[model samples]
Target chain A: MNRIDKKEAKHLLKQMMQIRQFEDAIMDLMARNIAEGGSHLYAGEEACAVGAMAAIRPDDYITSTHRGHGHAIAKGGSLPELMAEILGKETGVCKGKGGSLHLADVSKGNLGANGIVGGSIGIAAGAGLSIQLRGTDQIVLCFFGDGATNTGLFHESLNMAGKWKLPVVFICENNLYGMSVSVERACAIKDLTKKAVPYNMPAECCNGMDVLAVKDMVTKYAAKARTGEGPALIVCDTYRYYGHSRSDPRVYRTKEEEKSWRDRDCIITFGRKMQEQNILTEKEVTDLEKEVTAELEAAIDFAIKSPDPKPEELYKDVYFESPSS
Target chain B: MREITYRQALNEALSEEMERDQRVFLMGEDIAVYGGAYGVTLNLMQKFGEERVRDTAISEAAIIGAGLGAAITGMRPVVEIMYIDFMGICLEQIGNQVAKIRYMFGGKTTVPLVIRTEGGAGRTLGAHHSQSLESWFLHVPGLKVVMPATPADAKGLLKSAIREDNPILFIEHKMLYNVKGPVPEGEYLLPIGKAEVKRPGKDATVIAYSRMLYFALEAAKRLAEEGIEVEVIDPRTLLPLDMETISESVRKTHRAIIVEEGTKTGGTGAEIGMQIIENCFDYLDAPVLRIAGADVPMPKSAVLEKLAIPDAERIYREIKTLVS
Candidate 1:
């Protein structure tokens, strides 16, 4: 689209690097038993989250998947609060209740991430409905994996959003595999964008490794959604550099295939582009990397120093205080 | 005070709430133009317009999820699931999402929504349509399960559920829709977890709610004729069971009999019986007895369905045996 200016390119590259650095810190903490439960890192699919999320305003809503750290960061999430949540500290965004999978920063218009696959599809449509009812021009950008297209909620939400002309953008990050199962084996159709045909919505696909391509595509669709043209679909052909979760060895894919995807790493490619365009100097790039690393390290220290919830806190936040019988 | 059918009382509550608050809206399948499958929401679409009175497709999960999302965004959405049997289709949204959103979000968001559905077996609607599944929602921690036995409660409690900040599973009985009772005129809100003693007595206590409350009250009258005066207590809300009122009654009567239309096994009655033993074990004069439907699917045949569910006769017999 030739729309990537110097400022936009720098922002996208910085956001992608921040996400990568944050996930790497989480991996290190998980190794040391500092963060409990699964961490679905968004290392390889950084461009999909940063580009798509950066296209929307702070008030525009976005529903995320289990692998949602990048989306949260791009949507203006607090580094300390997110790290604290993953570390199960009382100062977390969800007050230590929701770990990695259920991170939510409502103030940033993040409806929250879901542990269940495709669980947030219908919720995104609902947020769209709310915006429409409120007579706002804001659009909802719903993020999900390729595996979500196989769920009933995918079809139901798409049809409802289409019928109602709700202002929503359904962005599918087709990272090829859902856990160990490859998309080729699970899906009958090869092109994920074709699934949007039945819903009669505008559908497109882009090189997920290119931040400019993803941002341009999402921005175009999001504009249409804001103008009340109904929901649109954009499938980002990407791959996760890490395994689906911490426990996964990724035995399903060959090492050669993994190396091929890593060579096209979104962060490196975007950084190189920024440097070649004279948008950022090598020193600037190196300084941004150090900044992200230091930010992540400080967040980790804050999380470590934060106290665990008191025993009495177990009874709070339940809302329903039924008599203990 | 004015006498109205349970359906009219519920309609009044919805109408009054919608009128009082601009944030309150209604959404469900067949609720807008059709006035709901049970006619409880009749003429609402005309009053509220299509924007506020939304008629959804036959997508139960989406309806529930949308309502939950709307509620989180500061909208009071009252969703009707048509029948309790259809709750299975959307129970994931309720159990996994709606019930846990507030707590999982660390109480940052409030899901002020009500899921209203009718459940009971009287008409021959077959095994699927006719089933009382209130016990299913009682096991969920963050949900408030409410069942109104009288028109007054049906009106006041529905208003209260709409006003509550937590998600509520408001289970209305199909048989109680036509039951007439006096509802107060204006601004009546019943507390969510309070139990009311319908008829006070001393020999035994009959713990029941919704449609079964009527059967228990009738059985209490028959038991009175036989010199066994039974106290009838209606637990309006199940999740926050009014164990205090229940235990107080059990302490006075020293005997208890629970009546419900749901199956006997794993029924809420068993939970109440256990609570009675735990709290008032020293005051008990006899083992708590439960008169519940047989542990089987509701049959379509009239005769079989009648035998499958508990009735006034069954409650009377159970109370007589417990008091003896």
Candidate 2:
């Protein structure tokens, strides 16, 4: 095991805590009818996004899933833009056109999160192809749930990526459910990593609750892929604390089962480990929490106050026509 | 000037564009090895190799999804659907993703993609394969829909669509593929969204597109023997339609007849009829006439199929009523 320094560990812990607090606040806002529309919470999967994002450069691209707040935040997307997009404000990242499921920050190399299951896998492969064609050393990280692995698009994208030697890392966040259906029921083969073998790509499974473990494994794989060693698939055994969406009561899983994963909450595990190692003092952790709370509140306020898109602007930007024309 | 079939003209356009720009490539079902179902992409795989001229699986959504991704990332992709009816499997990707990407992204992206599909019901292919669905795309604002009726326009307009910085749905009539005409040999581009007057006359304006343009012209030739001079106009591109030219023709001719192979109810002709009434209603001598396919689905029987879609005889009948 490669040990990270105390400061690095503290910084990573702070980011994870920030993601947790932000998601919790979004849930609260949704309940209060402040954030309209359906929202998929990322409460229990912060470590997967934060750890994998920590391993990549800002210029390296990433395609995300609908449960994507953590991925967006870790990839350096502005909180104001994300919040505004959810609120359907004109100042949002996609200018109110793309809501929660379609958040994008191209400047930070974070491709948009897709509404369709397994939609972004092919997109990520194409992004990898773009990088290869441009002779750039950038790699694309594609994040999808275990449910998406069963999609034909997944196999198609994986096969193409393998054949083309595209530089991409396919990350599967196996929360063990595809919406209401269990992974066991949906997939014949439980282990998604094994599916990568037929494509001639390296595959690995990691402890999704352990941020450092995920970070270390991803760093190695990402470095290899960036150097043109081809694509890699990493299956992170994670869990979602809440149900699939805002409406799901989560009756599929037993209370004991939910509690078991909750006990290994990524944010709690990382914070406790950092405290035990004396990396972050209690006051520093509290200050970080307070800072994130204030930031989330400010973002919510900005989004609520922003005006809606003008009706006349609907026809604009449909194409990249010349301005003079 | 050079003489070539519409199919060869389209093939030459694809070949020339691919050679000129490395980012331009072609992908479709059986487009590579089989040279396209209509033979519009023949011998391209041999010239550009498999990497550029790709043959994808039978997944329509995946084929178009790959095209969307490639287009946004700086590649100009020309994707061919075996038939327009297959767009049902990939409409969300084309209508929602490819069409709205640039606008939804605040102009931060560009989908320079062209989806080439053949429509029209002369092949006796039945309801599943044959249908003219241009109105479905024209109803969407983000897409630019073009239908070239002649060999020369097929080559020039396709080249323009390839060079365009937006998503264009280039609809070709299956019946027009074998038709031969004079095409310029060198690099030439026809302006999109512009209508052309094929035969100028004074009595009535016959507006049409795709295979319907041939019928309209034939009807006009037949009407000329009866002392009815008809102006035949083809609104080559439907979405950004040249309303000015069409309205001007209507103003000169006084009478108007909109002809299309698609169903008359809610068809592209209906939209054109509405535009004429809105813009040039006062200049009209009579209510604009619409000659189109029957409201029912295209039939498999040869005689019934003939009755379903508009032809020269039907167009001539409609023109006679309007002129009388």
Candidate 3:
């Protein structure tokens, strides 16, 4: 049974709607060529980030992936700052230095989105080590794709985390595709969650399209990690409606395949479910949509008006104390 | 002041830093109970406990990645890589991650990490265990590389590397661990990126670091008896090469010879030679020379290994050819 109440479901629906609108605005920005580089969109995976992040504390650390805008927003990151960072503006979260793939809001406990595959897994373990040593209740959430499981670092990090009993939750947003390669061709194990069994770490598989199910599962597992149970791997079987990045046409997968995953869209399914259960009215849904659209528009306007970073600032932050200084 | 071995000096630095800051900790393979592969961190786990002194699995990439993660999130991690040759397995974490994180993050984050690993060949540990591959790290930007020579330098530079808010690769020579020198009792932090003149002379400048610095000093003494004054300079920090001190020494002698234990191709000697030509080209009276190891994998036999690397005799011979 889902632990979420009627009021909590409404809140989750609003947050999910917010992420959809934000990602849609990003697509518009990419179409106009205002956002450079390969921008990984997070349209279908909204419930995974929003659900998992909502269960953790604001101070708890999280290391994201290339498709990180949703995770950052769900972790209480500023919309204007994220948009500015994507647009490479001075007022961006990282002062325009990190750009899109490297977006980070450290003050809000987002360790930044990494460009490398399987890069942030070990970092999350390290952060958990810090919390354990300091004797704090803080937990760390590491979000990665199914592709990361193939790297040696993933095994190494999990082994260390299990041995030390570090307070970290390894959440694999198994979108089933590593770029153009499908999960069937990539991983030997059909059930990706079973990969964590070798490390003696507890593992689970949750319906990622159900926001309440994801939120309930993360809440229970995150509590276990906090109470000195060590690291746990939670696999959220989700999907991305768009291509791998801005450049990918996603020709590798068929229309039937994409439509099958699209039918279970978290936002549309959850919103209708709320109305059917009388948890929320149609009037309430319309109001939330209008409010979220305006919020996203304001964020876009703020980013567009922001100034570009100066060329001289390039050499400023390479090292904390450079040799010349 | 009290005299201590290079190994003891490193142990003292780790203990003092851990005592001073609760955030400071040590994590490596066999470091806690086994006292480290080289015993550089002997008795640390007993004093600091398992929480502060962590013993990790034999995973270099995990050690480096965890250290980076701990650093950016408020803790100060000093990881041990057992041997410098093992860096080949974990260079992606150091080069692509730690070295690029802060810069790629727009300087919003700082990785205050120190990786202490021993390198250089005198021991017949073969190619996998013995190597002077500091040059590989020197090629990377945003990384501070420090190769301390004597006991004092080992103690002081390590303390500095631990306190500094940057990722530093602290390379210790394998043979220098037992060598003793004067080291201050407590609280000493040597400034990085500064060169020290071990012996002042007039005819020529001998630039070296780590174990090579000792060879340069021995050669300088032998040359002094022969009425040839050779100045020996140890550029302790390599990445931020102390070009100012090096250029000043070059102007006085008008000649320079760099001695390094690594291969002649793309060694530290090559970098020093290029800098000498670029900055002190007008002051030069003769072409710059370098005494470096032969271009080959380290051999198992002691005789062949010695022939491959530079020694006191080779330094003396190289300086004789440059000044005579």
Q: Each model's TM-score?
A: 0.98, 0.92, 0.97
Poorly placed runs, candidate 2 (over 4 Å): A185-189, A194-202, A323-325, B295-299
Q: What share of the true interface contacts does each candidate keep?
A: 0.54, 0.41, 0.68
Better of 2 and 3 by lDDT: 3
Tell me how many clashing residue pairs each candidate has.
0, 0, 0
Q: Write the per-residue lDDT of candidate 1 for residues B22-114, one digit (tens) a residue.
A: 888998999999999889889999998998999888888888888887887768889999999999988888998889987777778777889
Alpha-carbon RMSD of each model: 2.1, 2.7, 1.9
All candidates: DockQ = 0.52, 0.44, 0.58
Put down candidate 2 lDDT per residue, A65-167, tens digits, no spaces: 8888889889998888888888788988889887888888777887778888887787787778777766889999999999999987788788877877889
Residue pairs in candidate 1 whose N, alpha carbon or C atoms collide under 3 angstroms? none
lDDT of 1 at B176: 89
Comparing 1 with 3 on DockQ, the higher-scoring candidate is 3
- Largest DockQ belongs to which candidate? 3
The CAPRI-style docking tier of model 1 reads medium
- TM-score of each candidate's B chain against the true B chain: 0.99, 0.99, 0.99
Rank list by DockQ: 3, 1, 2
User: Which residue window of length 10 is worst by lDDT in model 3 chain B?
Assistant: B100-109
**Ten contiguous residues minimizing lDDT sum, candidate 1 chain A:** A316-325
Give the CAPRI rating of model 3: medium
